[model samples]
Target: MLRVKNPVLPGFHADPSILRVGNEYYIANSTFEWYPGVEIHRSRDMVTWEKVASPLSEKRLLDMDGALASCGIWAPCLSWSDGLFYLIYTNVRSWNAGAWKDTPNYLTTASSIEGPWSDPVYLNSSGFDPSLFHDDDGRKWLVNMEWDWRKTGSHQFSGILLQEYSTEQKALVGPIQKIYPGSEIGMVEGPHLYKKNGWYYIFAAEGGTSYEHAMSVGRSRCLTGPYEFHPHNPLLSSYGHPEIRLQKSGHASWCDTPDGRSYLAFLCGRPLPGTLDCVLGRETSIVELEWRDDWPYLKPAPGEELFPSGAVRNWPADSFEPPVVLDEYRKKGEFPPATKSIEYRFDGSAIHPDFKNLRTERDPEVYSLTSRPGFLSLRGGQSPVSHWGQSLLARRQTDFSFSAETKLEFAPTSFQHLAGLCWRYDETNQYLCALTFDENLGRVLKVLTFVDRQFMHYDPVPVPGDGPVWLGLTVQVDSGRFRYSPDGKTWRILRPVLSAAVLSDEFGGMGFTGAFTGMFCIDTLDYTARAYFESFKYTVL
Candidate 1:
C-alpha cells in the first residue's frame, strides 16, 4: 500500500492549505498573480513535498502591483495555534469588467512555519475563500465563500459565511452568519473549516474549476449552523470520471499522521491525453481519508506506479529523494535542493534580498549569483501584457515528454527589447520564443502566438544574434515545439507547432490556470533591461 504521487505540490499549485505541525507537514497555495505571495509546502512522511516560508513575504503581505493574470492571491488559510502561525488571504482586486471588485481579505501571523510573518490583518471584503477555525472553548471562527453581487439572481454564489474572530480585537467580530448553501453544485468556491468528532466540518469547492470540478462536504453540531449535507457528496471528484487521469479534482485540505493516518491534500488536474487540457496547473495531491459512519471516505486504493501515471502516485518516504533532472546553478549558496531547484515565482513585489540568493524569489541584482559568475541575471519588466513587472522565471510542465533548455546572454537594442522562452497561460495567453532586435530581421528569432487572448502569430527567425542563444521548449502532449541553437548540438524547429492546448484549463484564462514553462525578460522599453541565464535544463523523456 504505497503509491501516492498526485501533484504533491507541483507547478502552479492551486488553492491548497494543509497543515499538521508536530511531525511536520504544511501546505499553502493560490498565488494567482504569482509574486512572493502564498505558496508554502513541507512534508515529513505524507509523501515528499518541499518549498517553505513565504507568508506573503512582505510588501505589506503581498501587493501584486497591477495583478491581473488570474488576479492576486486567493484561498490561503493556513493555521496552527499556541505556537502561532495563521494566515488568511484574498487580495483579488477587480477580476476584470463584470466586477469582482477590490476583494480585500488579509490576516497574518507566524511564530515559525518558516516565517517572520506578522503584518497584515484586515480581513473582510465579504467574500472569497477565507478560513480560520480553532474552537474548543477558546473560540475563533472565520469561514467564507459568500460573494453575491446580485445582478439578476440564482443566488449568485451567495452561501457559506460565518464570523466572530477577535484574538483580543485583532478584528472580525459579529454579524455575517449565513451558513451552508453550497452543494447545489454550482461554482461554490474554496472554503475550509474542520473539527472532527463532535463535528463542525465544511470542506467546500464546488463545480467550476473546470471539467466541472468538485469536492464537497458539510456538517455542524452548531458552530453556528443547522447544516448537514454530505449524503455521498463528492468527498472528492474527478468529475464525470473521464476515465480517470486525475482530472480537475476539488480543492481540499486535511492532514493527520504520526501514525493515526488520515491524509488528503487536494486540488488535482493533469490533463492532456484525451483532452481536458490542464497543462500542469492546479496541483498538490495526496489522498487516503477514511472515517466511515461519521463520513469522510476516499480510499479506493489501487493506483500507484507513477512516472506520471497521469499524476498522484505518491513518493518521498524512503529518506526523501527529490531531483528530476537538471538545475545546474552549481549549488551556489544552496537551498533549492528539494525537487531540483527552479521555483522562482515572481510577478511583482516582495522578492528582495538579492532575491533570496536562489531557491525562490528574485529581483535584486536583477537576479544574479555574483554578477554572471555562474550566470542567471534576468532583468526586464512589464509587457507579458503587464500583470506588472514580468521578469518571469518558471517551472512546472511536469512531463508531457519534457525537454526544456536555456542558455542566454541577451543583447538587444530595442524592439521593445526581449529575452526568450516562455509557455505561460495567463496575462493574455502565451507563447513568446523571443530574442528580438528586428528592425526588419537583423538579429531575429520570434514566435509570439497568444490565441484566445488575441495576438495571433509572429513567427520570424533570422538568427546570428552575435552571442549567447540556445533557447528551447519541447513538450509532446498537446504539441509545443519552439527550439533554437546556433551550437549546442544543432536544433532549430520553429515553424508552427504550439497549441499546447493553448495552455489549457480548457483554453486559457479562467479555467483556473496551469502551464508555465519558464524564462522571460520582456522590457516594454526598458525598466532597466537585463537578461542573462545559463544552463537551466529540464529533461524527462
Candidate 2:
C-alpha cells in the first residue's frame, strides 16, 4: 500500500491547478514574484511527485522588473483539451498600488509540457486568476473575477465573469457576462469550472486567502445563468475552526483517477501552534471526496475529527493519506550534524528544481556551476530592490526553528559591492549578514534587518579575513540570531538576538510568501561584482 502524504507538494507551492492527461497527472502552482513562473510537478501514484518543467521560462511572457514581493504571477490555471495544453495567469504589477490597476492576464499553450510554449496571448485586464473551460461540445469559455475596486461600495469584487473563446483565433470574443456573482463569503477569487452529472459546477475561493479562506460551490443547468447555491455553501474549510491542522485551505481543483475515483487538490498551510506563523508558506494538499444527491462532501482521512464534533469519516488508506512530513517534529538533538547534509530534497530543500541549480527570478545566465566546479558563482546584477536583475537564489523556510550557514568568497572594492546570506520575506522585508570592505573598518562583517522595506537595525563587526567568510543564521521560532565565523571551529555574534516573528504573514504587511534564507550578491552600481559560494548547510532543529 502506498502512503500518500497530505501536503503532496510542499513549500511555496500554492494555488494548485491539477490536470490529468491519461495516466499522467500534472500540477501547476503559483510562483508569485519568482522567475521561471508556473512551476509544474508530475506524479504517477499520486504520492511521490517530481518537478518536470516550468512553463513560463522566457522573459517575454513575464516581465517582473519592479514587481513587489507577492505581486508576480497569482493563480495559474492549467488544463488539457484536444492535443494542446493551455495555461492562464496574471501579472500582478503591485498589490499595494491598486487592486485592479495594471493587472493583466495572459494565456499560453504548448504541445508538450516540456517544450517551447507559445507566446503569451493577452486575455484581459479585468482581474486575476483567469481560467479556460473547454466544454464537452468543443466550445471554449474563459472565466475570472471582474475587479471593480474603484467602485464606491462594499462589493469592490465584482462577481465572476465569463466570455466565449475561439481556440483557432487564440482570442476571446463576444460580450462578457457576469455568470455567478460569488458566494456570501467576501474576497472571492480562484474560480474553476467543471461539468459533471449534466450540471455545470463552479468552484471558487472565498474569505480572502488567509486563515478565513474557504471553498464554495454553485451549480446551474446552463453554462452562464442564475446558478443555485449549494445548501451546504462552503463544502470544505478550516476557517473559525482553529483546531484543524490545515489552515487557509481553499483555492481547489478537482480530478478523477483512472478508475473513476474523485480527489481534490488545494492550497493549505501549517503554522506554528500559538504564534500562528506559517514559515512554510501556502502548500498543496489533496483530499478525497464523495458525491451524494448531486452534492460533494469532503471525505476526511482516517481518524480525522473536526472541531465541535463532526461525523467520523475515513478514506481508503491506499488511495489517500493525510499530510505527513519526516522532520517537522524532530527535536534539535535528534538531527545529528553528520547525518544532515545539504543534498536537496524537493519537499524540504530551498533549492527549487534541484540542488546546485541556483536561480534568480527572471535573470538567466547569471549564475554558473561549470565556471568553478563544486562552487556556485553569482555575478552582481541589480540590487534586491529590482525584480528582474536581482542576482539572488533562495529556498523557502520550512521549519520554525532551523540553522543555515554558508561560506562566501568575495573581494569587494567599492561600497556598491556586497555579498552575504539573506533571510528574506520579499524585497522589502529581509535580513542581510554579509562581508564587505568598509573604508574606515577595512574588512568588516555586518548584519542588517529590514521590515516593511526599512532598515530596523544595522550592526557591523571588524573581522580579520581576506576571503572565505562563513555567515550563519539560527532561527528559533519567534527569535533569530546571526553569527560570523572566521574558521569553521570558532564563531562570533554579528547581531543582537532579534524578532523573526516579523517575517510572519500577519506581521510582514507584504506577506504572501514565507521567509527564504539563502545567499545573495548585489552590484547596485555595476554588474561586475562577483561572489562564489563554497557550501551551504541547512538543518531543521
Candidate 3:
C-alpha cells in the first residue's frame, strides 16, 4: 500500500477537476485572474504529480483584460470521451457589482492534453462552474449551478441545471431541467455528475468556500427526476474540526483506479500557524473512499480518526465555530516537504513553466529572453497596480519562511523607471524593493509597500555607481524585510521589517489568490525603459 501526503499540488491550485485516461490521471485547477486560465497536472502513481499543460494559453480562448482581483476563471471541469478531451470554464467579467454577476461560461476541446486546443465555443452566461457529462447512450449533457443574483446570501446559488448538448451542432439543445435544488447546506456550486451501479449521482460544493465548506451528494435512478440526499448529507468536510491539518476541505472530483479502488480529489487550505490566513492558497488533496450499502464514505488512513467523535454527526446549519490554531496538527507529517530551492539563469529560449503573469498572456513587447542573451529583458510598461500591460513575472510563494534574490542591471534616469524584486498578493496589496533614481542621489535603492490600499515608502540608500545590483527579500512567518548587496557576498539591510501578514487572502478581504515573489520593471514615464535581470534564486528557510 502507498501512503500519500495531503496537497499533492500546492500553492494556489484550487477547484480541482480530476479525470483518468488510460493509465494516466489528470487534475485541472482554477487560475482566477492569472493568464493561462486552467492549470493541469498529471500523475501515474497518484503519489507524485507534474504540471503538463495550461490549456487556455491564447487570448482568443480567454480574454481577461482589466479583470479585477479574484474575478476571472472560476471552477474548470475537464472530462474525456471518444478520444477527445472536453474543457469547460467560466470567464467572470464582473462579480463584485451589487446584485449582479456577469459570468459567461465557454467550452473548448482538444484531442490531446498538451494541445493546440480549438477556440472556445460560447456557452451560457446564466451561471458558472459548468461541467460536461457524456452519457452512455452516445449523447452528451451539460450541467452548471444557476446563479440568481437577485437573491442574497446562500440563495444566490439557486440550483443546478441540466441540459443536453449536441455534439454535431456544437451547441446545447432541448429543454433544461433543474436536476437537484441542493441540500439544506446552502451556497451550492461546483456540480459534477457521475454514473455508478445503475445510479446517477450528482456531487456539489456547499456551505460557501470558507471554513464551513463541504461536499454533498445526491443520487437518482432516473436521469432527470427528484434525487434522494445521502443518509449523511455532507460526504466530506472539516467544518468544526479545527484540530485537522487541512481546512476549507471541499469542492471535490472523483476517479477510480484500474485495481477497482475509488479516490477523490478535493481543494483544501492550510492556514498560518495561529491565524485563519492561508498565505499559500487552496491546494489539491486526494483520499480513498469505501462503498457501504451503495453509498460512498471516506476511508480513514491507518491509525487515523475520520471524525473527532469517532462517528459522523449531523452538524447544525450555524455550526461554524471560530477557527482554532493547533500548531501540533501539522507536526504529524501530513504535509508534503517544502520546496527546498530553485534558481533560474534565463539561458533557455523560453521562460520556466513555474512562472505566470497577471491577467494577460506573455506579450513579446514586454518581455523577451533573446533580447539580452543569458538575461531576461523586460521593457517596462504600466505601474504595478494597472490591470493592463504590466511587465511583471512571478511564481507562487509556497513556504512561510523563504528568501528570494535577484540581480538587476537597470539604469534609471527618473523615478518613474523602477526595477527590482517584489512580494505580491495582488495589484492592491504588495511589497517592493526597487532600484530607481532620486533627485538628490543619482541612483538609489528603496522599499515600498501597499497594504489594504494604503502606501508607504522607506528611506532610500544611494548607490555609488550605475552597474548591476543584487536585491534580496526574506520573509519569516508574519514579517518580511529587504536587503541589497554591491558584491555577491556582502549584504546590507535596506529597510525595517514590514508586516508580511497583509499579503494574504484574509488581509486582502476581496482576493482569492495567494502571494508570489518575482522580479518586475515599471516605467510610468514612457513605457520604453528596459531592465535586464541576470539571475533569480529562491530558497525555503
Candidate 4:
C-alpha cells in the first residue's frame, strides 16, 4: 500500500505554496523577517520533504529591517513553467504613507532550484500574499490582498483581488478586479490561484489572520470572472474554539501524488502548551485531500497532529533522506566562537545594532557572520553612520533548558561599536547586556531592558574586565525567571521590569517562528565597525 503518511510536515513553516514538476514537487513558504527569505523545500510522493534553498537569501531579493520579523514575507506562491520557477510574494514597507508600515508585494523567477536568483521585480500593487497562476490559454494572472475599503477610506482590513501579470516587464499590467470580498465570507488575506476539473479555484484565507481565520474556495470560468463561492465554503475546519493550533486555517497550496491523489500544504499552529502550538506564529501542515462529488475533504489519521508535533519525514525513502545537523558551536573548536544566546555581555562586546541579523535579502552585504572556516567577523558599518545595518546571530526561543555562548574581542575605539546578547520579542520588549571598551573610558558592562517601548531596567553599574569573558543566559520558564551569566556556570539575577505582559496573544505570543529560537549572537552590529569572535556555542543542558 502506497500510504501517504499523515501530518506530513512539522515546525514553523507556514503559508506553503507547492508546485510539482514531474514526480518531484517544489514548495515555498513565507519567511517573514528571518532572513535568507522564502524557505524552499522539495518533496517526492507528496509526503517527505527537505529544505534545499531560499531564493530570497540575497540582498536583492529582500529587505529585513524594512519590516518587522512577523510581517516580512507573507504567503508566497510558486509555479514552475518552461525551465524556470516563478515566485510571487508580498512585502508591506508602509501603508497610509508609512503609518501601517511593512513590506510590499513582489515577484521574481529562478532557472535552477538553489539560487543566485534574479532580483525581485518590485510591484506597486497595494496588497499581500501574492500568488501566480497560468490559464489554459497560456496567459498568467496574479492574486493578492487589495485594501478595498480600508485603503480607500475605512478603518477595517480588506479583501483579495486579482490582476494579470507581465513576466517580461516584471509588473502588473491590468485593472485589478475584486473577485472575492472576504467581508462577504470572512476571508481576509493570503489568496492562491489554482485550476482544477476545468474550473478555476481561488483558494484563500479569511478573517484577521488570528483565531477567526479559515480556508475558503471560490470558482469561476474566466480569468476575469463572475466567480461563485463554494457551497461547502469553509472547506478545511479546525480549532476555532478553546484556542488550539487549528485556530487560524487557510493560505494553502495544492499537491498531488503519483497515483493522482491530491493534498494541501497550508498554515496551522502547533498543539500549544504541549509539544504542539500556540499563537507564537503560524506553522505549516499537510493534510490528505480527496475530491468527493467535486468538493474537497481533509481527513487525517487518528493520531495525526499539525506542525512542530509533525515529525520530519523523508519521503520516497529509497531515493533520499533529509540530513540532520547538530549545532555544536564549540565541538570542533570552531572560530569566532558560537553566538551568545541570552547573556550579560561583559568586556569587549558592546551593543551594535548595525549588524542586522534579522535582515532579509535586501542588505546581506551590510552584516554577515558565517560558518565557512569558523571565524565570525563583524565588518565596519556599511557606511560611517549606519544604524540600519544588522549583523547578529539569533535563534527562535522555543525550548526550555538551553544556554547560549559567545567569545568577544571588544576593540571599540568608541562605545558606538559593540556586541552583545539579547532576547528580543520586538523593538518594544527586549533584554540586552553588553560589553564596551571606549578609547577614553576603558572597559565597562551594561544591562538594558525595554517593556512597552519604555525603558525600565538599566544596570549600568560599570565593572572593569580584560581577556575573553563568556556571556550566558539561563531561562526557567516555569518560574518566570531569566538569569544572566558571565561565565556559563555562576548566574546573576537581573530583573526585567515590564511595561506590559510579555506572555499572551495580546503582547505577541512568541510561539513558533520557523527559525525562531532563543539564540546566541555576536550582536546586531554595523558593517563598518569591525569585531572578531573566537567562539560561539549553544547547548540544551
Model 1: ten consecutive residues of lowest lDDT: 316-325
Candidate 1 colliding pairs: 3-313, 4-313, 4-314, 5-312, 5-313, 5-314, 6-312, 281-514
RMSD of each: 20.3, 5.1, 5.1, 8.3
For candidate 3, write residues 110-141 as lDDT tens digits.
Answer: 99999989889888888988999888888888
User: Taking the tens digit of each residue's C-alpha lDDT, what string does model 2 give over 81-159?
Assistant: 9898999999888666543456799999889999689899998988888999999999999999878877754546778
Off-target runs (Cα >4 Å) in candidate 3 are 152-155, 305-310, 313-338
> Using TM-score as the measure, which candidate wins?
3
Candidate 1, residue 427: the lDDT equals 63
Model 2, CA-based lDDT: 0.75
lDDT of each: 0.71, 0.75, 0.85, 0.56
TM-score against native, each model: 0.36, 0.89, 0.94, 0.74
Task: Report the number of the highest-lDDT candidate.
Answer: 3
Q: Which of candidates 1 and 4 is the stronger one according to lDDT?
A: 1
Candidate 1 local lDDT, 50-151, one digit each (tens): 676766755767777766667677778898887898888988877655634567888888898777888898978877888898887888889887777764
